[model samples]
Target chain A: MDILQALANGFEVALQPVNLLLVFVGCLVGTLIGVLPGIGPISGVALLVPLTFALKLTPESAIILLAGIYYGAMYGGSTTSILLNIPGETSSVVTTLDGNQMARQGRAGAALAISAWGSFIAGTLSVLALMLLGPLLAQWAIRFGPAEYFALMVFGFSTLSALAGKNMAKALLATLFGLLLSTVGQDPQSGMSRFTFGLLQLEDGMDFLVVAIGLFAVSEVLMILQDKAPPAVQATVGRVYLSLKEFTFSLLTILRSSILGFVIGVLPGAGASIASFVAYTVEKRLLGSRARFGQGDIRGVAAPESANNAAAGGAMIPLLTLGLPGSGTTAIMLGALVSLGVTPGPQMFQQHPNVVWGLIASMYVGNAMLLLLNLPLVGLFVRLLAVPSWFLIPAVLAVSFIGVYAVNNNPFDLLLMTVFGLVGYVMRRLDFPLAPVLLGLVLGYLMEVNLRRAMAISNGDVGFLFSSPIAIVLWVLAGLSLFAPTLLSRFVKRGALGDDEI
Target chain B: MSNPTHRTDRIVGVLLLLLSIAYGWTASRFEVGMLSDPVGPKPFPYLIAICTAVASLWLILRPDPDPQWPPVSFWLPLGLVLGSLVAYAYLLVPLGFIVVTTLEMALLAVLFGARWWQGLAAGLAFSLVVYFLFTAGLNVPLPAGKIWGLGR
Candidate 1:
């Protein structure tokens, strides 16, 4: 079927009463979590995944709800970035540059309004693009063999080596660390014991939940402890809605950023962070003399906010079509999909159209809901900040632990979680990226099994891996991406604008 | 202390490299069956070991500029947390829900930097609340301690 027909079918599924209700609730919860300091969509979704099992909903409904939370949280993340300098996710770090400046200058209300509208504009447009591209990519990926899949996973891993660390060597080490961690359980092919050290609990391998929650959520709590109190933020909110002139001025910036962000997001490993950075640069370049960009430029607030949301949409393309995740959050989402018994490559479109389209359609509905809910309910969301951290942190940590335990009613997972948390804390202190570890844990086994299967099928012919033109192209691209950072840095330095300007 | 941070990185890298070797040796213990293909179950772990070794070598040879790391004092609480988790694992099945949870929360609260008085009080209160919520409210079966008659 054509993309339009599929979307229409998707709308039919999404517009169902229960599905729509789930989408609304997911958005509401996502925004609340995003507005809270230190929690992102991953935490929100992780906290909620168990609830879905309790509800016993269909796979399609579960994904729609989860995806709604994923993107809805992105919208809410900009709220704190604008009002306070604290970003809920790294994706919003660029938003804080001009957003908090606007807030301090008494245009806090305007900054929030522009951010919401820009999110809406970018989100809606990106969904439209997703509608068009998802089907094409799915159809194209249908021809992939196991060798191609292995090469694709290799491409995904190499991106970490290319972009994840201060230098290629460090990134490669981080990737190795992730791969080793991925090996901590029973070997898939040999049924051989590895790294388990005779502990019965290690037989099944490390749970992604244990690793993810410990690394992202628990370690974050430890980091928060290192600080005395969060930065003080006071906002005099005025005119919660955008004025006509303000809307006109920001709309152009939003459009430009959305296009730029979508393009960057489509490329594996270039996600919201890079998109936001590029959007900011472009907005500044256009603003030139009028650029109060680093200060309180309203366009400054709009650009990154729009770009990041668009990039989030762009990330779904590779995940859904190619079974490749462009960012950490998407990697978790892919894990969630796999756990739900859904293989997220081209075949998913054929086998589970409802799940794919329902997710896409929910994105449209979710963006609208976020814009509407955030406007009048901004005060209510901000009130969450006033809750004492004593109650908030413990309750959140307990709930996360409960969620982990609920999976198997096993306390061993809890022990594993705490250990991973400490390891995560140490890794963070040393400036290592946590995302690569996750990507490795989720993809490592799959890459290994596929490579082995492909080799076995070829009867030990080494040339079989490179025989495929697609595999050769991907390997070449991976090689080039390894050097991309150094080249880009040199090019930027040699240009007229200094590092600060870019 | 010229590159104090690099020292930690180098040490950690070496340790991780050792871990990779250990993992590879473990993989080798399993009779690695070749599926008539160059790649097998052991191939990925071996690749990881190789990459880790190379990276660790590079880190030791050309370490990045070091920065200050957190002091050992901060790790003190980790002991308490770990102890609490271990106790919970073993005692949850034996000691009744109320006793185990109360003790665990109390210790955790103290470890989280709360004052002793406040930690004890808050911990007891929250533990009771959770006990009631999970057991009385939700009706899920909970661990009953040696004093089974009192829990029942």
Candidate 2:
């Protein structure tokens, strides 16, 4: 009863005309970002963080807008994959396999329709799951002490590092690198400078936004320069409607993949890309020679399309409930949340239920808006694909620079951003994961604070970290995350690995 | 970078190791001022440095196969693009938001293959649009031009 009452109040906040309009605009821009190749939700939201602050919207409205963009992007991401055989983003990479196959056979209409429908169904289902599950998780997390929090974050970093980049070593290095960056400012507890290198600007610590926009958005511009532009492709959506038989065929696939994806997404480090690939593989094995997986099967489009959207919804559970961001985009969202003057954690649900539920309720409305928008306007987004890399890439960079400058009006941050951009570009080429560095940076301060707090509480007894059963469980999970991938990786293609860290 | 060998990994490994050592060395010297908290700020940095050292040592011992870098020619233009950003940083106050942003975008357009005048027009249009959005809609202040003695 309390849950329904809270969600209803959330609906009240979300339905305000201004909030509705923000969500609509967020969805529209999000789809554009998704339809474009070489840019993803991380860059899109990273560019918006400062703008959102400058706009002076309430934290609830800001979150609603950003959340709209996050899922709306998942919707638009499938368009290029189905039409051009180019995934709009990494999460939709699997869609390219079967999505393009359908397009080539003149069934692009059915593929697009089915994907929209599946995304709609799974998105709604996963939000429902989040609604039911989020409060429960928060309640459990409310009992955490500093020791439990420390152990839990260690678990998060371990899983993320092990599963993220080209190899565990590179990923761990990125994680350590991020932790080092987080320690640059004066230590809050001791008031001692850790690694300021004597720079006065660093007293407040490295701003995550400057680094993120620089690394993800600015580097994307430099990256486009290295490769020639995508050649113009000839493709069309014939009818944009799925036959009843096609609908029935993919319905079961959508439901199954949505469930599978939600569970994968709820894990600490696992995200949409993994859920989609694993769902596709599982469907392939389930069909056992009856299903055509890689060559434009309807179920192929259904599996990843729904799974990724559902995973996006599922990924939010940890972020809202536990203040843990499992993937890169969510980490950026976490940054947005922090900037909005909202601390994300167990208390968020109780202290700012309007922000919490408003965001949740907005996703439902946003998903509906996306289904309507995608059904008719797939052509509009596809036309946007013609935007030359020369034009779009520069525009994106301009936004990154301007937005970072707007945040503090500091040119030094701009220089710092450029440095990170080059660093990000090189790291990508070397196959070092970028997300863990972000994850480490975002989570590092909290991890250090909690570890120090636990140590203080325990009077420097190292055994206190392992003292609690919850802490023990978290440590064990951390170990499993490091080892489980090597054991379970045989099921996935090597191509489907690594880059999913996004 | 030109040769395309495992040495990229080794070089990166050495750099990381140096960073680890540098971090560790600096962290070890922090004077314990508080003596209030049971464990001061030193342990976390030590943990991070040690982790980096271990990871970098592994990378050094067992380097991965070579990853091919983009063509060497990429450096000049890449530098130009990155340079434009840094230049825009210092120049924004002096040259103004409109002038610096226009130049940055135009440089990007021209570098990626556009006519200079077209790039200029496009850059001006985009910069003006952002200018209007910020000043008119959000009521936010942006530097006009310090040398011109414009809006403070």
Candidate number achieving the greatest lDDT relative to the actual structure: 2
Candidate 1 docking: what grade? Answer: acceptable
Model 2: CAPRI class = medium
**CA lDDT for candidate 2:** 0.87
lDDT of 2 by residue, B1-152 (tens): 33446788889999999999999999999988747688888999999999899999988876777888888888899889877888988998887888898888888889878888878898899889988888788876778888898854
Worst 10 residues of 1 chain A by lDDT: A493-502
TM-score of each: 0.91, 0.96
Q: Each model's C-alpha lDDT?
A: 0.77, 0.87
Chain B TM-score, all predictions listed: 0.70, 0.91
- Model 1, B84-137: lDDT tens per residue? 666776676567656666566556555555666765676567767866665565
Predictions' DockQ, in order: 0.43, 0.72
TM-score of chain B of 1: 0.70
Query: Across residues A239-343, which tens digit of lDDT does each residue of candidate 2 receive?
Result: 799889999988999999999889878775678888888888888878868898887899999999999999999989989998989888898888888877898
Clashes of each: 2, 0
